[model samples]
Target chain A: GAGVSQTPSNKVTEKGKYVELRCDPISGHTALYWYRQSLGQGPEFLIYFQGTGAADDSGLPNDRFFAVRPEGSVSTLKIQRTERGDSAVYLCASSSAGGYNEQFFGPGTRLTVL
Target chain B: AQSVTQPDIHITVSEGASLELRCNYSYGATPYLFWYVQSPGQGLQLLLKYFSGDTLVQGIKGFEAEFKRSQSSFNLRKPSVHWSDAAEYFCAAAAYNQGGKLIFGQGTELSVKP
Candidate 1:
């Protein structure tokens, strides 16, 4: 079975540009998550979606970051006015609905803001 | 706040040697722990998880982990490591209250020598 997958394995943008990263979760997964991994650091949670609504967005660093899963499967993470500080690997993960399920991750999209 | 810590920034071991990667976590309640591996250009892969029941848990690719609540640790071990095992290992705790988002450690880079 195909695991979670992200589009545009790498993205480069200038500062103050806007970028969107896409994620395709597994066929039946109802839970999707986004995270950011900076150099020499672990991944930090960004947001989570259950079905079509975001259940948690506390990890989102600032107002410039936003995410959505409209159809309940594919998710898009949007960043506005990209900054050099936003340069990092954006990771997407998905899991089935329920308790304590293992998260399947995608090959993250590495975003570089220059 | 829930957090995870992987004390070793890096470790090197010869192929066929025993391996141990230490992971410690801080959470208010009984935590759901996990081990994940990531190779260059790949997504995170689950190695094992500890939710309940027995303390010792086995995972794919000949990896295993032991949960020690007394020490608030979940250390990963492998009887003999293969050259292919060289990669980054992450220890994480599931923040169930916040929609099962993962709190990851800084990660430990493992280099296997011939």
Candidate 2:
């Protein structure tokens, strides 16, 4: 079976540029999550989606970060005015429901802001 | 708030030697614990999880973890390691009502020596 997958394994953008990272969750997974990992640090939560609506966005660092899951199967994380601070690996994961289900993670999109 | 701590930032062991990685978590209630491994340029792969029942859980790649409610810890161990096992390991925890959002610890990078 196909696991969660992210597009553009690597992305390099200049400061102040805009970028969008895509994620394709495993089929039938209703809970999706986004996390960012900085160098020498663990992954930090960003946003969570249950179905089409954003169930939790408190983890989002600031207004510059936004995400959407229109159809409930795919997700897109949008970053506005990229900064050097945003240069890190953006990870996507999905689970069957919410509680104790195992989360399947994608390869992640490494965004390097120059 | 829920959190996890991995005390070791890096560890090196000779091939065929025993291995142990420490992981401690803090949560209000009994939490769901998990171990994940990540290779360079790859997504996270689940090693094992502890939700309930047996305290000892086994996972892929000859890895296993013991969950201790008394200590609030779930440390991973292996009898012997191979060079191929070199990678980064992350310990994660999810609270009862957090809707599957995981709190990850700073990873421990394992290096194997021949």
Candidate 3:
């Protein structure tokens, strides 16, 4: 089976521009999560979705960042007025419904804000 | 707030040498623990997870981890490392109510030398 996947393996954009990153979760997975990894650091949680609604979003840094998982399968992370500080690898993961399941991750989209 | 900590920023070991990566976590109760590996330009791969049962858990690539409740730690270990083991490793934790969201620590980079 195909694992989770993300589009635009690399994206270069100017600061202040808006960018959208997409993720496709594995089939039958009802839990999806987003994380950001900066240089020399670990991945920081951003948001999590259960079904079509966001179950937890406290990890989102600010209002400038938003995510939507319409139809409970594909998710898109939207960053408004992107800053250089937003430059990092955006990773998406998915798992079967439950807190104890191991998450399968996607090849991240590296967003570089210049 | 739940958090995970990976004490080592970077480590280098000769091929065929034993390896250990330390991880400490803070949570009110026993939390779900996991170890993941990330190669440059790739997605994170789950190494192992500790939810319950015996403390020691084995994983892919000969990786293993022991969850210690008294010490609040889940350290990853490998009897012998290969050059292909060179990558960034992350420790993550999650609570039962987190809706499957994971809190990750600053990753430890491993370099295997020939």
Winning model by DockQ: 3
DockQ of each: 0.76, 0.85, 0.85
| Interface RMSD in angstroms for candidate 1 | 1.4
Model 3 chain B poorest 10 in a row by lDDT: B94-103
Tell me the lDDT of model 3 at B111.
97
Candidate 2 regions with alpha-carbon error over 4 angstroms:
none
Worst 10 residues of 3 chain A by lDDT: A96-105
**Candidate 1 lDDT over residue span A31-56, tens digit each:** 99999999989899999899999998
| Regions of model 3 farther than 4 Å from truth | none
Can you give the TM-score per candidate against the true fold? 0.98, 0.97, 0.97
Candidate 1 lDDT tens digits, B1-114: 788999999999999999999999999997889999999888899999999999999999999999999999999999999999999999999855667789999999999999
lDDT (tens digit, per residue) of candidate 3 on A1-114: 999999889999999999999999999999999999888888888999999999899999999999999899999999999999999999999999958798999999999999
Candidate 1 residue pairs that clash: none
Candidate 3 per-residue lDDT, tens place, B1-114, comes to 678989999999999999999999999999899999999777899999998999999999999999999999999999999999999999999897787788899999999999
Provide the lDDT at B50 for model 2. 95
lDDT of 1 at A95: 94
